[model samples]
Target: MKGLTDRQQEILDLIKSNLENNGLPPTRADIARTLGFKSPNAAEQHLRAIEKKGFISILAGASRGIILNTEEALGIPVIGLVAAGGPILAQENIEKRIPQAHNILSNKIDYYLRVKGDSMVDVGIYENDLIGVNKKNPIKVGSIVIARIGEEVTVKTLESISSNQVVLKAENSEYSNIEINPEKDEIVFEGTCVGLLRDFS
Candidate 1:
């Protein structure tokens, strides 16, 4: 909480707002573009200052990587399932965030959603699991992600079979693979699964 100036606070506000709106933190370039900085380095400097103050942490080697200390804020909406094939926030897409973890809920969570299927069981995510998703797109291969195929919201392991072909494969044999031809099917990635919350109690 030290080393941050008023200007840095403004930058933090802007960054927080952007995260709320997009479900992902902004990049150095994005910050620069938004604040009218001459270069991304300027934004980087401010971000470093913010990190030093314990307001955020920058994930090294990751693009647009920034995670706020959630304990400092509250009421981060938990985004549930996204309507596959449409905007992520569509009414049919979002669920509700029930307060569970004080450490997690205290921090600004953009949203929370529950896993409705077992397609990701191979990865240890199961049905009714609460997942924290950052609002963004273009997830990497092998990363567990949430995708929309049409009106249905599904949690699956994302695999890129080809440049234009994506395979949403299930972790269990009981389910089948969903092959998506970007040129044919309206497939869209809502975000990558960052963390999982299961209520064992």
Candidate 2:
């Protein structure tokens, strides 16, 4: 916390909270959106400043690679597939609460969603992985998001948003991108993916 600017301290705290709760570090895009930094580059710059202050370590070529020097424990709810006509965070949908102490990063996580398919495997989100979700962050293009189309829910990257349609792309080539006309289709954004958790056990 020493030698870091106020914003840097805030980002560091977010990194700590994310690590404790989700067991993974937050991506630059996750930090940027949560703190309203306009772009992930701004978050990366702040992360560099925090790293210089000796609070966190940033690893290149990894999205959730920020490492904290200390440890803390916290629990976040893990949601399974959404139940019919129920809210995503409904008690019935919660599979379990996961607690972790690892080098995870991100902003405040609302819950961890248990992935059910291989559509996002190319981005490292595979079936049965638990992805951290933050409902408060602003959704943006290129951000991976948990979306609901009517009664079905899926995770995909937000490719583009136009005045007429929104495009969601799957990370795997086996799946086609989904395009929705806002005026004619019902699309609900549950939350944006901030981090991921995989259980080897």
Best by lDDT: 2
lDDT of each: 0.74, 0.85
Give the candidate number with the greatest TM-score: 2
lDDT, residue 164, model 2: 85
lDDT of 1: 0.74
Please provide TM-scores, in order, for all candidate models, with all chains considered together: 0.55, 0.62
Q: In model 2, where do residues sit more than 4 Å from their true spots?
A: 1-74, 100-103
TM-score of 2: 0.62
Q: What is the C-alpha RMSD of each candidate to the true structure, in Å?
A: 12.6, 13.9
Candidate 1 — worst ten consecutive residues by lDDT sum?
Answer: 100-109
Q: Candidate 1 regions off by >4 Å?
A: 1-74, 80-86, 90-95, 98-109
Backbone clashes in candidate 1 total 12
